[model samples]
Target: MELITLLLLACALAMDSFAVSITAGLSLKQFNATTMSRISVTFALFQGLMPVIGWSLGTNFAAAISRYDHWIVFALLCFIGGKMIYDAIQQHEQAHCINIYSKRTICSLAIATSIDALAVGFTFSLLEVDIVFSAFIIGLMTFIFSFAGLTIGLKLGSIFQRKVEFIGGLLLIAIGTKVLITHLLT
Candidate 1:
């Protein structure tokens, strides 16, 4: 893939991380630079690493499923994206939980949000792309955007939290469609 495509993929992949960071910021009462940095770094690392791991797994099985890889990517992306959208639309009705920034919460959120990236990594293995460069771009973009998102959420309040998730869901679905279309045309 070209650098531009890699960058776009990174940005698309970071949407979830960015949204989660915003929620974290909204819940933070005693936020500090260190806390934000830790969140960003942890998220970025996981986001970057999951794809590498997925790609490795995909690479091993690439020859076995090369003919149907696009379909697989499309299916996984659609499932994940659709689920995110569904969750967002349904989330607002739930009662707000008490705000807490424990180690467990951070770890849980980071893992939960980065699950989609693992799938993306698998997709990367099927495509003609640069894994190292793409993963790096993804990690860097996620870190920067997530940090900014948290700051923005801190200032803006949690009223628009659902909006963030909605946008993320839209982006993922769009990306999925694009991947499928490109594969079809090729």
Candidate 2:
């Protein structure tokens, strides 16, 4: 793919990470640079890694990955999103329980968001693209977008507070549903 096309693809792939980062920002009580960096970096790493994995798997397994990748993504996102909504509801009376800063949650979110990238990697293999360079661009774009999304979400959250988390959860579910629908339709 041309650089412009690759860049556009990167942006497309990064959308999920961007939205998830926004949700992470919404859950934070205060903005912490370290936390934001951790989240963004984790997302970047996964976003980068998934494509390489897909490339490695190559066309031989593309059909298999495509067959189930959307389902896996849907399950992960729905579970996490549902948990966020449930936590938000419970935290209305009690202290907030979901920690966006937690390593486990971060890893889960990263993996959940990057599943699509794996499929992209498979496409890259078929296209005979330079996987390393493409993955780097994807990671770089995801890092930038994820960081910006979190910052924006933090600003929005300052005005909206806890309700932002609920919205974030809904966004996640919406994203998951969109992924499923797109695959099913195609």
Candidate 3:
């Protein structure tokens, strides 16, 4: 995949972490770099790790699905993107609950946010992309977005959650469509 596409994918995947980080920021009564870094690191770690896991699993089955791999990739991205949009719709009705003091809560949030990346990993495994580089980009983007979200959340609150999610979802769907079209054309 192109660097631009990988960057965009990383950003799209980071949206959940960004939103959660925003919530985490909102929960902060006072600014603490340690707490913010911890949350951001955890989110990034999971975001990066999930893809590796997914890629591993996908590679195992890549030969079986090679014939229709592009279709599968398209479907997986669309499904994840669709889910993000669906979740964004319902997210407004729910309350953000993040406990910075609890390791478990942070880890849980990180895992929840990065599930899409795991699926993305499955796609990456089939593609002619570099998994290590892709994973690094995803992790780095998640960290940057997550940290920024936390900072903004502390100052601005939860106003951007829905919009960010909605945009991220749309971006993923668009990327998926592009991949499918690119494959068909070639």
Task: TM-score each candidate.
Answer: 0.88, 0.66, 0.97
Query: Which lDDT tens digits does candidate 3 get at residues 106-161?
Result: 89899999999999999998995799999999999999999999999999999998
Q: RMSD in angstroms, all models?
A: 2.1, 7.0, 1.1
List per-prediction Cα lDDT, in the order shown: 0.77, 0.73, 0.90
Instruction: Order the candidates by TM-score, highest first.
Output: 3, 1, 2
Which is the leading candidate under lDDT?
Answer: 3
Please rank every candidate by lDDT, starting with the best.
3, 1, 2
Error of 1 at 179 (Å): 2.2
State, as a TM-score between 0 and 1, how close model 3 is to the true structure: 0.97
Q: C-alpha displacement of 50 in model 3, angstroms?
A: 0.6
70, model 3: CA deviation in Å? 0.9
Summarize candidate 1's per-residue lDDT along 19-134 as a digit string, tens digits: 77776777666657888888888888888888898898889888889899888888887887787777778764322352435777667767777888888888889885678877
